[model samples]
Target: MRRKGSPHLVVIASDPADAHFCNVELRKLKTGAIVGRHYILRSDVQTFVSMYRRDGFSPVEGGNND
Candidate 1:
Protein backbone atom coordinates (compact mmCIF):
# COMPACT_ATOMS: atom_id res chain seq x y z
CA MET A 1 0.00 0.00 0.00
CA ARG A 2 1.10 3.55 -0.71
CA ARG A 3 0.48 6.78 1.04
CA LYS A 4 -0.99 9.80 -0.67
CA GLY A 5 1.38 12.58 -1.71
CA SER A 6 4.38 10.37 -1.02
CA PRO A 7 7.34 9.88 -3.31
CA HIS A 8 6.93 7.32 -6.03
CA LEU A 9 10.48 6.24 -6.50
CA VAL A 10 11.41 2.62 -5.81
CA VAL A 11 14.76 0.90 -6.12
CA ILE A 12 15.21 -2.85 -6.09
CA ALA A 13 17.43 -5.61 -7.37
CA SER A 14 15.60 -7.38 -10.16
CA ASP A 15 18.21 -10.03 -10.89
CA PRO A 16 19.84 -12.27 -8.34
CA ALA A 17 22.91 -12.71 -10.54
CA ASP A 18 23.33 -8.92 -10.75
CA ALA A 19 22.74 -7.97 -7.18
CA HIS A 20 24.75 -4.79 -7.53
CA PHE A 21 22.50 -3.56 -10.28
CA CYS A 22 19.13 -2.05 -9.46
CA ASN A 23 15.97 -0.99 -11.14
CA VAL A 24 14.83 2.53 -10.40
CA GLU A 25 11.08 2.68 -10.80
CA LEU A 26 8.47 5.39 -10.88
CA ARG A 27 5.21 3.98 -9.61
CA LYS A 28 1.64 5.11 -9.38
CA LEU A 29 0.97 6.09 -5.81
CA LYS A 30 -2.65 4.98 -5.81
CA THR A 31 -2.13 1.61 -7.48
CA GLY A 32 1.43 0.81 -6.43
CA ALA A 33 2.06 -0.13 -10.03
CA ILE A 34 5.22 0.72 -11.88
CA VAL A 35 4.89 3.42 -14.51
CA GLY A 36 8.51 3.56 -15.60
CA ARG A 37 11.80 1.88 -14.84
CA HIS A 38 15.49 2.13 -15.58
CA TYR A 39 18.39 -0.12 -14.65
CA ILE A 40 21.32 1.52 -12.92
CA LEU A 41 24.76 0.36 -11.99
CA ARG A 42 25.85 0.29 -8.36
CA SER A 43 28.39 2.99 -9.02
CA ASP A 44 25.67 5.30 -10.25
CA VAL A 45 23.60 4.92 -7.12
CA GLN A 46 25.30 7.93 -5.58
CA THR A 47 24.27 10.01 -8.56
CA PHE A 48 20.64 9.42 -7.82
CA VAL A 49 21.18 10.14 -4.16
CA SER A 50 22.91 13.39 -4.97
CA MET A 51 20.25 14.37 -7.44
CA TYR A 52 17.46 13.65 -4.98
CA ARG A 53 19.25 15.58 -2.29
CA ARG A 54 19.65 18.51 -4.62
CA ASP A 55 15.96 18.33 -5.41
CA GLY A 56 15.02 18.42 -1.71
CA PHE A 57 13.72 14.89 -1.64
CA SER A 58 13.20 13.42 1.81
CA PRO A 59 11.81 10.19 3.18
CA VAL A 60 8.24 10.13 4.43
CA GLU A 61 7.15 8.77 7.79
CA GLY A 62 7.06 4.96 7.92
CA GLY A 63 8.94 4.79 4.64
CA ASN A 64 11.94 2.57 4.16
CA ASN A 65 15.18 4.37 4.92
CA ASP A 66 17.52 1.56 3.94
Candidate 2:
Protein backbone atom coordinates (compact mmCIF):
# COMPACT_ATOMS: atom_id res chain seq x y z
CA MET A 1 0.00 0.00 0.00
CA ARG A 2 0.98 3.65 -0.49
CA ARG A 3 0.56 6.68 1.73
CA LYS A 4 0.11 10.37 1.02
CA GLY A 5 3.33 12.10 -0.05
CA SER A 6 4.85 8.74 -0.84
CA PRO A 7 4.07 8.82 -4.51
CA HIS A 8 6.02 6.08 -6.24
CA LEU A 9 5.72 3.11 -8.52
CA VAL A 10 6.44 -0.51 -7.71
CA VAL A 11 7.49 -2.92 -10.43
CA ILE A 12 7.43 -6.59 -9.49
CA ALA A 13 9.01 -9.33 -11.57
CA SER A 14 10.20 -12.86 -11.13
CA ASP A 15 13.62 -13.23 -9.54
CA PRO A 16 16.64 -14.53 -11.37
CA ALA A 17 17.23 -18.25 -11.48
CA ASP A 18 20.35 -17.80 -9.36
CA ALA A 19 18.35 -16.82 -6.35
CA HIS A 20 18.17 -19.27 -3.46
CA PHE A 21 14.42 -19.11 -2.99
CA CYS A 22 11.22 -18.16 -4.75
CA ASN A 23 11.32 -14.37 -4.87
CA VAL A 24 10.20 -11.31 -6.74
CA GLU A 25 12.02 -8.10 -7.58
CA LEU A 26 10.32 -4.91 -6.47
CA ARG A 27 11.62 -1.56 -7.56
CA LYS A 28 10.43 1.99 -7.96
CA LEU A 29 9.20 2.99 -11.39
CA LYS A 30 11.42 6.02 -12.01
CA THR A 31 13.81 5.79 -9.14
CA GLY A 32 16.99 3.88 -8.33
CA ALA A 33 15.82 1.95 -5.33
CA ILE A 34 17.69 -1.31 -4.82
CA VAL A 35 15.43 -4.30 -5.46
CA GLY A 36 16.33 -7.83 -4.34
CA ARG A 37 14.41 -8.97 -1.33
CA HIS A 38 10.65 -9.06 -1.81
CA TYR A 39 8.99 -12.42 -2.43
CA ILE A 40 6.00 -13.56 -4.43
CA LEU A 41 5.04 -16.66 -6.31
CA ARG A 42 6.73 -16.83 -9.70
CA SER A 43 3.48 -17.94 -11.26
CA ASP A 44 1.93 -14.54 -10.55
CA VAL A 45 4.24 -12.61 -12.87
CA GLN A 46 1.76 -12.41 -15.73
CA THR A 47 -1.09 -11.28 -13.52
CA PHE A 48 1.03 -8.59 -11.88
CA VAL A 49 2.56 -7.27 -15.07
CA SER A 50 -0.77 -7.17 -16.88
CA MET A 51 -2.38 -5.19 -14.11
CA TYR A 52 0.60 -2.84 -13.87
CA ARG A 53 0.72 -2.00 -17.54
CA ARG A 54 -3.05 -1.75 -17.84
CA ASP A 55 -3.19 0.71 -14.95
CA GLY A 56 -0.52 2.98 -16.44
CA PHE A 57 1.37 2.91 -13.14
CA SER A 58 -1.06 5.29 -11.48
CA PRO A 59 -1.79 5.25 -7.77
CA VAL A 60 -4.85 3.11 -8.17
CA GLU A 61 -5.89 -0.42 -8.91
CA GLY A 62 -2.68 -2.42 -9.34
CA GLY A 63 -0.38 0.41 -8.33
CA ASN A 64 -1.70 0.87 -4.84
CA ASN A 65 -2.39 -1.99 -2.48
CA ASP A 66 -5.43 -0.25 -1.02
Candidate 3:
Protein backbone atom coordinates (compact mmCIF):
# COMPACT_ATOMS: atom_id res chain seq x y z
CA MET A 1 0.00 0.00 0.00
CA ARG A 2 2.80 2.39 0.77
CA ARG A 3 4.14 1.88 -2.72
CA LYS A 4 0.83 3.16 -3.95
CA GLY A 5 1.41 6.28 -1.87
CA SER A 6 -0.55 5.15 1.16
CA PRO A 7 0.72 7.00 4.15
CA HIS A 8 -0.37 4.40 6.70
CA LEU A 9 -1.87 1.00 7.39
CA VAL A 10 -3.61 -0.38 10.48
CA VAL A 11 -2.49 -4.01 10.77
CA ILE A 12 -4.82 -6.41 12.61
CA ALA A 13 -4.65 -9.85 14.09
CA SER A 14 -7.26 -12.54 14.72
CA ASP A 15 -5.85 -13.49 18.11
CA PRO A 16 -4.53 -11.32 20.92
CA ALA A 17 -1.90 -13.95 21.48
CA ASP A 18 -1.02 -13.46 17.82
CA ALA A 19 -1.25 -9.71 18.03
CA HIS A 20 2.38 -9.31 18.90
CA PHE A 21 3.18 -11.25 15.77
CA CYS A 22 1.49 -8.58 13.69
CA ASN A 23 4.34 -6.19 14.24
CA VAL A 24 7.11 -8.67 14.66
CA GLU A 25 8.77 -8.57 11.26
CA LEU A 26 7.54 -5.17 10.29
CA ARG A 27 9.84 -2.21 10.38
CA LYS A 28 8.34 1.00 11.73
CA LEU A 29 8.02 3.72 9.12
CA LYS A 30 8.07 7.31 10.28
CA THR A 31 4.81 7.80 8.43
CA GLY A 32 3.34 4.83 10.26
CA ALA A 33 3.61 6.68 13.54
CA ILE A 34 1.22 9.39 12.37
CA VAL A 35 -1.83 7.14 12.60
CA GLY A 36 -0.73 6.20 16.10
CA ARG A 37 -0.31 2.53 16.95
CA HIS A 38 -0.78 0.25 13.93
CA TYR A 39 -1.71 -3.00 15.64
CA ILE A 40 -5.40 -3.86 15.93
CA LEU A 41 -7.82 -6.80 16.03
CA ARG A 42 -8.47 -8.50 12.71
CA SER A 43 -12.12 -7.49 12.87
CA ASP A 44 -11.38 -3.78 12.62
CA VAL A 45 -8.31 -3.75 10.39
CA GLN A 46 -10.33 -4.22 7.25
CA THR A 47 -12.64 -1.36 8.09
CA PHE A 48 -9.82 1.09 8.61
CA VAL A 49 -7.84 -0.09 5.59
CA SER A 50 -10.97 0.19 3.47
CA MET A 51 -11.73 3.66 4.71
CA TYR A 52 -8.26 4.92 3.93
CA ARG A 53 -8.20 3.15 0.60
CA ARG A 54 -11.49 4.68 -0.43
CA ASP A 55 -10.73 8.15 0.88
CA GLY A 56 -7.07 8.18 -0.13
CA PHE A 57 -4.14 9.27 2.04
CA SER A 58 -3.54 12.60 3.66
CA PRO A 59 -0.15 13.04 5.27
CA VAL A 60 -1.43 16.11 7.11
CA GLU A 61 -3.72 13.97 9.23
CA GLY A 62 -0.61 12.57 10.84
CA GLY A 63 -0.25 16.00 12.49
CA ASN A 64 2.72 18.37 12.61
CA ASN A 65 5.03 16.10 14.50
CA ASP A 66 7.91 17.24 12.38
Candidate 4:
Protein backbone atom coordinates (compact mmCIF):
# COMPACT_ATOMS: atom_id res chain seq x y z
CA MET A 1 0.00 0.00 0.00
CA ARG A 2 1.07 3.58 -0.73
CA ARG A 3 -0.08 6.92 0.56
CA LYS A 4 0.03 10.03 -1.53
CA GLY A 5 2.47 12.77 -0.40
CA SER A 6 4.32 10.18 1.65
CA PRO A 7 8.10 10.37 1.51
CA HIS A 8 8.47 6.63 0.94
CA LEU A 9 6.41 3.99 -0.81
CA VAL A 10 5.41 0.64 0.61
CA VAL A 11 6.86 -1.94 -1.77
CA ILE A 12 5.45 -5.45 -1.84
CA ALA A 13 7.36 -7.91 -3.98
CA SER A 14 6.48 -11.53 -4.86
CA ASP A 15 8.98 -13.03 -2.40
CA PRO A 16 11.44 -12.20 0.33
CA ALA A 17 14.39 -12.32 -2.05
CA ASP A 18 12.67 -9.86 -4.34
CA ALA A 19 11.54 -7.87 -1.34
CA HIS A 20 15.12 -7.64 -0.11
CA PHE A 21 16.28 -6.71 -3.54
CA CYS A 22 13.54 -4.13 -3.92
CA ASN A 23 14.31 -2.69 -0.53
CA VAL A 24 17.84 -2.03 -1.69
CA GLU A 25 16.67 -0.62 -5.01
CA LEU A 26 14.11 1.63 -3.39
CA ARG A 27 16.74 3.26 -1.26
CA LYS A 28 18.98 3.68 -4.25
CA LEU A 29 16.14 5.09 -6.38
CA LYS A 30 15.67 8.07 -4.13
CA THR A 31 17.80 10.18 -1.89
CA GLY A 32 15.92 11.67 1.14
CA ALA A 33 12.76 12.31 -0.96
CA ILE A 34 12.02 11.52 -4.59
CA VAL A 35 10.53 8.83 -6.85
CA GLY A 36 10.23 5.63 -4.80
CA ARG A 37 9.12 2.00 -4.93
CA HIS A 38 8.23 -0.32 -2.10
CA TYR A 39 7.95 -4.11 -2.24
CA ILE A 40 6.13 -6.83 -0.32
CA LEU A 41 7.11 -10.40 -1.14
CA ARG A 42 4.16 -12.67 -0.30
CA SER A 43 3.53 -14.88 -3.31
CA ASP A 44 6.46 -17.27 -2.76
CA VAL A 45 7.56 -16.12 0.69
CA GLN A 46 8.97 -19.52 1.62
CA THR A 47 11.35 -19.66 -1.31
CA PHE A 48 11.90 -15.96 -1.00
CA VAL A 49 13.03 -16.26 2.60
CA SER A 50 15.18 -19.34 1.99
CA MET A 51 16.85 -18.43 -1.29
CA TYR A 52 17.65 -14.95 0.09
CA ARG A 53 20.24 -16.14 2.57
CA ARG A 54 21.87 -12.75 2.99
CA ASP A 55 19.40 -11.66 5.66
CA GLY A 56 19.76 -14.78 7.78
CA PHE A 57 15.98 -15.15 8.00
CA SER A 58 13.58 -17.36 6.11
CA PRO A 59 9.93 -18.32 6.14
CA VAL A 60 8.61 -21.87 6.49
CA GLU A 61 7.61 -23.66 3.32
CA GLY A 62 3.88 -24.10 2.57
CA GLY A 63 3.08 -21.53 5.21
CA ASN A 64 0.44 -19.22 3.92
CA ASN A 65 -0.54 -16.54 6.38
CA ASP A 66 -2.10 -14.76 3.48
Q: How do all models score by TM-score?
A: 0.62, 0.38, 0.35, 0.25
**lDDT per residue as tens, model 2, 1-66:** 222344444545435674432443445545747454456565665566566557554334664232
lDDT of 1 by residue, 1-66 (tens): 133456565443344578677666667666879887778886776786566566655555565423
Please provide, for model 3 over 1-66, each residue's C-alpha lDDT reduced to its tens digit, 9 standing for 90 to 100. Answer: 332454454343344467433321122356444445455544565555566557663223453311
> What order do you get sorting by TM-score, best first?
1, 2, 3, 4
lDDT of 4 by residue, 1-66 (tens): 223343443233444544443331222215544355435444444553444444432333443322
- Among these predictions, the greatest lDDT belongs to 1
Segments in model 4 whose C-alpha atoms lie over 4 Å from true places: 16-29, 32-66
Cα TM-score of candidate 1: 0.62
Q: Estimate the TM-score for candidate 2.
A: 0.38
- Backbone atom clashes (below 3 Å) for every candidate: 0, 0, 0, 7
Error (Å) of candidate 2 at residue 25 is 4.4
Please list the C-alpha lDDT of all candidates, in the order they appear.
Answer: 0.60, 0.48, 0.42, 0.37
Q: List the residue pairs that clash in candidate 3.
A: none
